[model samples]
Target: MLLQDKVVLITGGSQGIGAGAALGCAEHGAHVAINYHGNSADAEKVVAEVRKKGRRAIAVKGDVADASTATAFVKAAVQEFGKVDVFVSNAGICPFHSFLDMPQETLERTLKVNLHGAYYMTQAAANQMKDQGHGGSIVAISSISALVGGEYQTHYTPTKAGVHSLMQSCAIALGRYGIRCNSVMPGTIATSINKEDLAQPGKREYMEGRIPLGRLGRPDDVAGCVVFLASDLARYVTGASVLVDGGLFVNLQ
Candidate 1:
């Protein structure tokens, strides 16, 4: 197993990509920790799935936007699992609004949960990894929206762009400590986060035709990449941005 015996913590793991990644890591022999904001039932479902794979698993609850909560969640994981070898800051929220009338509160909320939350959550995880002296991996879930800019995401895209920036900066700052940081930028994924919008007439069809690969991405599509970055296979990679966009990036460009 690529991640044999490793301890991995994934934020927002109750469902969607986070849940998929938790299962992926567990299948590869990593003890998994899932942190959910407000869905214990769903989080427990993920925990159950991981345990069925014969891997140790736990579900943590916290609002990643708060630094103290972020810190506490990592500390709690360390308490249960001894140490963290991989941290996936995957919790995110995207609310749509045009720049002309985007509310300040909306922008702030998006930044707090997506950008600021990830910044400190990963920092706390990095500290744990450094203390262990084994080095580790940090995978920030970014979005192609960061690169392409969204029509209704004037306030949202910057936060994702910020995640990419954070990955690059941390890759440099944490390199000496043997810690590596990178990002996985996904495009038009079909998850609860976008379900309502996707269900609208023509939305799904429009995206299907737009994406070069002829479909929206699944949670597992991105999960596979997360496992790679967190595994030893990506030992030499850091500050890298892997796109799980199914060739739409180059097509629509």
Candidate 2:
């Protein structure tokens, strides 16, 4: 019950890592506001699960790529929960493509949704927290790709790195107000984002072999860390990037 009675907001929370974090936060006694891009059905399901935990929950639909969506999202959460205590910038998209032939639109979309989206959402949340005068926590869902690279993730890795950097700088910018900023870098997570890629011949096995843990990561594995960062347990933690990669990073060396 580390987050007991807190108000948490999450972007791209319809499924995968985002959904897992929503449920994890609720389990710790926090009311949740989930923002999803499209898929209302999936978003509502996550909201239902949060309510089943006896915590209040709501599903917000919007594209994080749009700057206005951030302010609207925070406003919606405040209207429902009275205040914001934690914000998780988890909405992102990754379209695997080779660097040499990467389409302009693909690169642009990835940047807008991943980096710009996180920036807008974080700024909006920080403004609300500043106005409230109680400070808060902002956790970006970065990736191990931020530290390394993938042959097909040329356009995606930079966004993750940018997100990780965003948290570090925001930690300094928002520190005077007691707001903490950090990131969780997951490695080889098995989610829809990589379902097709992992299905390629030997792809999944090859990835597992790279990790010392002998397995790929689950959404919950990263969710637990998100919950911890959002909770008072990490009150003194800021400008940090915690790896939820099951030692995959060290194994890479």
Candidate 3:
């Protein structure tokens, strides 16, 4: 087990890629703490899954956009698991809309949840890891959109780019303390958030055709990378961006 006996924390972990990472870490022998904004049932379901894997698990309810939530979430994890070894900043939202008619509320909420949320949680986790004196890993769930434009994601792409940038800067700032910060950029993952879009006629097939892998991504696809970065196998890895996009970006002509 790559993460045996380690403590891992994740935000927006009730579903999608975050939930996948939660279960993946547990399978690798880590006690897990998850944060979800709403939907207690979903959060508890993930906790149950983790426990079924024979790993200790807890679900903390809170909105990552709130700075205070970050502190409380970390405190709860420490209170339950003792220390934080891996922190995955995976909480985010993308409300697709035409750039011209994008709602102010949607834009603001996206920035708050995707960018500010990652910052606060990462900062809180880094502080805990530093105090523990054992070093830690931080993985931010950036998007492939960070490298390319999206017709309906004008307001969302910048936040991801910011997240990717965050890891790069934090990797430098926390290097002396042995904290590694990295970002994983996933492409067109088949999560609930985008299920409707993919459901559109021919949309799914078109996307699959574009990717060299010939299939859309699953939550586990991104989770596996998170697991690797969290493990000692990547001990020397830091300030990096790993693309879990299945060749979609490269397939571009």
Report lDDT per candidate.
Answer: 0.92, 0.96, 0.96
Model 2: how far residue 65 lies from native, Å:
0.7
lDDT of 3 by residue, 121-223 (tens): 9999999999999999999999999999999999999999999999999999999999999999999999988988898999999999999998999999999
Error of 3 at 35 (Å): 0.3
lDDT of 2 by residue, 1-253 (tens): 9899999999999999999999999999999999999789999999999999999999989999999999999999999999999999999999999999999999999999999999999999999999999999999999999999899999999999999999999999999999999999999899999999999999999999998899999999999999999988899999999999879999887
Q: Which pairs of residues have clashing backbones in candidate 1?
A: none
> Model 2: residues >4 Å from true position, as ranges?
none
| Residue range with the least summed lDDT across 10 consecutive positions in model 1 | 94-103
136: Cα error in model 2, Å: 0.6
Clash pairs for candidate 3: none
Kindly report which residue pairs in candidate 2 clash with one another: none
Pick the winner on lDDT between candidates 1 and 3.
3
Off by over 4 Å in 1: none
